[model samples]
Target: MSRRDSLPPLNPTRAFEATGRLLSVSKAADELCVTPAAVSRQVRALETFLGVSLFERIRGGLELTPAGARYLSDLMPLFSALRESTEGVMAGAPGRSNVLRIRSPATFAVRWLIPRLASFHRLHQDIDVQLTTGSAPLDFRREDIDAGIQLGDGDWPETHSQRLIPNELIPVAAPSRARRKGWKLERETLLHSLARPEDWTLWLKFAGFSTANTNRGMRYETSLLAYQAAVEGHGVAIAQKALVLKELEEGSLVAPFDMTLDRGGHTYYFAWPSHRPESKSLKAFRQWLAKVVR
Candidate 1:
C-alpha cells in the first residue's frame, strides 16, 4: 500500500486531532459539532489505524498521551494552512477576469469619475474598471460589485470606508444671465432637484432667507439636470461644489453668492465590506481612488 493510502482517513484524523488536543471528548465534540460518542469512535479508529495509543482514559474524562500531544502540534499548523489556502483561493474567485467592479451613484459617476477615467485607464491598462450605477444600499457579496461610492455620514456598519469629499452646497447660475452679488432674491427663479429638494431650503436657511418658499421651484429628478438648467440661464440651482467645479472654473456657471453651505456629517465615501479580505486588484483600485480624492 502507498503512504497516502496507509494513513488514517481525514475525518478520523480531524476527530483525533481535536479530541487529543482538547483532552475532553465532549469539548472536542462540541467544537466539531458531533456527539461525544462519535468523536470517541473516530479517535479509536485513528488509534487502531496507527497501532498507537493517542489518548488515555482518565477519572474525569481523557488525557492526551505524549505521542498524541506531538501529533496534535504537528497537525494543527497543517490544518490551519489548508484552511487558509482554501479561503485565499475563494477570496479572489470574483477577480478571475482582473476586472474592478465599482458601484456608484449615476450623477457622481457621470459628472466626476467618468471625466477622470481616461487617466485611470492610461495608468492601469491591465486593470479593467466596470462601473455600475445605483444609490441604494451597497452589498459587497454581490459577484458583480466589489466596492461602492456612498454619499452620507459614513456610518455604515460592517464596512471599511474612506471619505472622498464632503457635501458642500453653493448657489450657481448661468454666466450669461445670472444676477451678480447683492441681486434681489425674489427676482430669480430657483431651480430644484428632486434628489436634493431640501438643498435649497438648507442653504436658504443658512443664508437667513427663512421666509423664502423652498419647495416652490421647477423640480427635476436629478441635480445634474438642475445644474444644466442653471447653465441655460433658467435660474439658480443649489449645486454641490465638487460636481459643478468644472462649470464654475470654465465660467459656464458662476456662484452668484459667496456663502457656501457646508453641512457637517454629510460626506462622500468609498467603501467595501470589512470582513472580506481585499483582493490585490481592489486594493489597487481603492488606493487609486484615494489618490484621486487627495
Candidate 2:
C-alpha cells in the first residue's frame, strides 16, 4: 500500500473537471455521454472523497469555488500529458490508430473539403480522416492534431503553410433569384456573415459602393451559412467564388454578376507544424491536397 494508491476514480475526476470547466452539469454530461444527474452525482462523489467543496451552486449556474478553480488549473495539464503519453504508447501498438486529426474551419470543411474527402479515402484506404472545425487559435503542441486548413495570408508562425485556393468575393444567389432580380446588385436584399464583416464591405468597395452607406440584411455565423441562404433564395450573398465553384457549376446556385473582389490577403492554406515528425500518410494527403488545389 502507498499514498499514491488512494486516488479517486478517473470518471468522477473527469466529471468534476468538465463540470467545473464548463460551469454546467448538463454540458459536462453531454460531453461525457452521461446524464446531468449522473454528472452531479459524480461531482458530489469527488467532493466527498476529497472533503472539499469544488463548486457553488448559483441561481442559474454553477461557479467554481476558489479552491476548485485552482484545482482545475492544476489538473488540466496533468490530464493532457496523460493523454499524450497514452496516445504515444497506443501509436506503437499494432492496429491501434490510422487516424489523421485535421483541424479546419466550418465554412471550408462543409463547402469545399468534405466533398473531396472521398477521393482521399479512395487513395488511402488505411488512413481514417477525422475533421474537427473551429476558428479558435490552434496550438499544435497542446492539441492532438495532424494538420489544418486555414483561410488567410499564408503566414503562420512556426508552421509550414502553402496557399491552396485563391480567394475572390463575388455576389451570388439561386439561379431563379438571380434571373428575377437581374442587374440590381444594390437593390437586392444582402446576406452577410457575422464572422467576416469585412467580406461584404470589401466587395461593396470593389463594386464602387460607399461601404459607409451600405444596406443591412440578415446575418449568419459563417460564409457557408450565408452562401446557403443565397442558394435557398433568401438573398444575395457575397461569397468566395472558389469555394462555391461546385455549386455554380452544379446549377444549385448562380452568380448574379461577373464582378469579383480578389484581395491578396484572403486565401486558403494547407498547414502543419514545422516541427511535427512527418508520416507517410500525412505526406500523401498533403500531396493529394496540392494536386486538388492545382
**Which portions of model 2 miss their true places by more than 4 Å?**
1-85, 88-95, 181-183, 279-281
Query: How many clashes does each candidate structure show, in the order listed?
Result: 0, 0
The lDDT per prediction is 0.79, 0.80
Candidate 2, position 210, lDDT: 75
State the displacement of the C-alpha of residue 46, model 1, in Å, after optimal TM-score superposition.
39
- Tens digits of per-residue lDDT for model 2, 58-149: 89998888889888877765665565566667666888756678999899998889999999999887777889998765656445577898
Displacement of residue 67 (Cα, Å) in model 2 is 13
What's each prediction's TM-score?
0.65, 0.72
Per-residue error for 38 in candidate 2, Å, reads 10
